[model samples]
Target: MNIEYITTEELSKRIRYDVRTIRERLKDSVLIEGIHYIRPFGGRKILYLWEPIERDMVLHSGHHTLAIPMANGGRMNG
Candidate 1:
């Protein structure tokens, strides 16, 4: 796998997310350690792996509608 390490600024540009939001919210919530990002040599700086992030974003995106089951036993596609 050709893993590319990018800084917060670079990640922000690629994902169109604000640096502050990335640092404050997405860093630990959406972007997890060892999976989405890494702290090199146990350092404080965080470097994100672009491949996994992009892949998950596309996979989780609303590309197809799924049938959701309701409490009344009816299926609704949304």
Candidate 2:
């Protein structure tokens, strides 16, 4: 399996989000570690996994209703 790893700057460009937003808002909130990103060798540098993020973006897109994510990995639809 091949994974495309990208930096925060690259992710910002691909997702059309600001670098600060990705770093501050999205990271560890909407995008999770080990799922959407990883710290290689347990270092401080973060590399975002492109495929999972893209897949999730498409999956969650086109929704008119609001859904809040729960801590148990479920969503509370609103």
Candidate 3:
């Protein structure tokens, strides 16, 4: 499958989520590294994977939905 690479702004636009939210709240929490996102050739810039994140955004956007695993041994349900 040909994966689509998306920058922060592009992703935020499509999902209606703020870029800051994606970077601050979602990154490394709901969004996993190397799975849902990737950095450019040793660069600090992280580009989110469009397809997977999109799918996940739909799947996990809800109240009382502990869909994603948190790093602190907790779940993000609601």
Candidate 4:
């Protein structure tokens, strides 16, 4: 797949999510590694992959259960 890498601000505009919310809450919680985002060149800067995220957004847009892993090895559901 031809994936497009986007910055937090760009993603915010595309997804209508606040950049702060994405950075503070959604990052690592909903948007995960090797799936939603990546750190290119092993650097601190993060680049979000749009395709997977968009796919998941559409795929999970129904009344299905959603779960996300927490940093403390627990899970949160919605």
Top candidate by lDDT: 2
Ranking 2 against 3 by lDDT, winner? 2
Tens digits of lDDT, candidate 4, 7-69 = 999999999999999999999999998899999999999999999999899888853557787
Tens-digit per-residue lDDT, 1-78, candidate 3: 888999989988988889999899988998899989999897999888888986776777653354678899767765
lDDT of 1 by residue, 2-70 (tens): 889999999999999999999999988989999999999999989999998998897787544587889
| Model 4 ranges off by over 4 Å | 63-78
The true-structure Cα RMSD of candidate 4 reads 9.6
For model 3, name the residue pairs that clash.
65-77, 66-77
Of candidate 4, the 10-residue stretch with the lowest lDDT total is 60-69
Collision count of model 2: 0
Q: In angstroms, how far off is 41's CA in candidate 3?
A: 0.8
Estimated TM-score for each candidate = 0.78, 0.78, 0.70, 0.76
Quick one: RMSD of model 1?
A: 5.6
lDDT by residue (1-78, candidate 2, tens digit) is 999999999999999999999999999899999899999999999999999999899888844458888999887898
Candidate 1: regions farther than 4 A off: 64-78
